[model samples]
Target: MERASRSNMQSILDYTDKDVRELHEQALENLREIGLVNPVDAFKALSAKDSKGRNTTLLEIREIYVSPNVGTEDRELSRIITLYPEITIEGGGQYSQLVLTFENNRFPDMNRIWQILESYGKESAEYRENIDDYPMLQLTILPLTLDGRYGFVMSSPIMWFLTPADPAEEQPRQIRMLIEPGGLQFVQDESYSVEKILEESRKMMASYKMDLQRQLDKEEAEKEMQREMEAEHKRFLESNVTNHTFGYDENTARTAENRRQAWNDMQKDGKFKVGNKRD
Candidate 1:
């Protein structure tokens, strides 16, 4: 008996192992069919380093012309160039706007400041409207930080005319900086950590298993309820049916007995015979 119990337990364990293996295989097939791969593996496959052990950097620039007036252009030009260390002046027509691009081996120190301006520009309606007149700068920078701890900043200068509430008042021009940061390696590092990804996957699998178990339990409960209902119906029929027949009720049995008795009385009265000769 002890050996038999041990064999049964081993069989159960084997069945569970088979089920787990099948589930994992099905999950892998689904991933392959959908062209989905582990994030870490995909990242590693595309990872590369340059000769300097850094990614290449690219800069995008745009010049927005808000109005024809050039009152503030000269005053703002000096300050804007001073703010950005890599700024280089270029000649432009009377109506043309100036834009500059710069690339360096080291990450720019003004990247943080540009990020702040970008955030502000996203929230400003004036800046958005000005962007419609001038295209936004879009660039991809390479040679990311060696330690994957740095980022890049790209921005464009915008000029708009600010008119006083009164029409007779002088119209003054205003200039605003629009900036955006890219290649945020530090944030990606935290989000793409192996431990974090594994934790998330485990949580997802646990939730799925819980949902499957709940569905199975619901189906089992429904089947048990149906069986109980069928049993109760059978007992009810047995109690109500006076005869051993399945469908006949007590009233039907009584009616059949009465009919038989009437036939017997008729035979005794000679109105009917059990076996009559037809001659």
Candidate 2:
């Protein structure tokens, strides 16, 4: 019966925007009417209003932003954002600007949802290759998973802004993979359920890191070796020139002279400086 319930819940995860919005509205309504302040900061923070007069509390929504390079486009990003919740960064409220999530775990606190949001924003900045921009959107809960397996998830249409697709003729590009570690970063060997996947991913990442280090070391060694060889060759030439000793037997010297004469004869005439002397 429990398993069936879980299955049913999973099936409802893709509820349409209207469906999710209704549920989110219900949750907010419950919170407002009940005056529940268990997580007081988050309760108040979520109630903030923006210039347009719509905020998370009023609309009961979350907003997810896509790559700015893609611009505001629903068709360009809807599939990517909705399909890959595991690796997506989530944010909400006033502290929303400073948190990031991997799984449901926030670096600072896990029990508190508001702390989790702040942590998600912080982590996003921490892990991002570029910190100049905050890319996470305001995400609210309904179909959202608080399972600690994802940093954040959206439950309704009101919870996110629809990314507008460009009208330009160019076809949108598809993401090959979620390069960011995302929730996978939080898995530890101790978690019995997630241990196997976590361990394997760790091993693979370790191997790749080691291979990269080895390649860098090899390149450095090769460069050093080349430098040494060059120095040795230069030294050898210098030593030979300085010593000015042709370590040749009488026969070898005679042969060298004969070749020299042959080369001299090949030229139409000799062009020599006035003070030039031949040994």
Best by TM-score: 2
lDDT accuracy of residue 243 in candidate 1: 40
lDDT score for residue 272 of model 2 = 19
lDDT for model 1, please: 0.32
lDDT of 2 by residue, 98-133 (tens): 121222222111122233234445546575545333
lDDT of 2 at 203: 49
Q: Compose the digit string of candidate 1's lDDT tens values, residues 114-137.
A: 443454356343554334332233
Error of 2 at 249 (Å): 20
Q: List the candidates' TM-scores in order.
A: 0.23, 0.24
Candidate 2, position 75, lDDT = 21
RMSD of 1: 30.3
Give me the displacement of residue 258 in model 1, in angstroms: 18
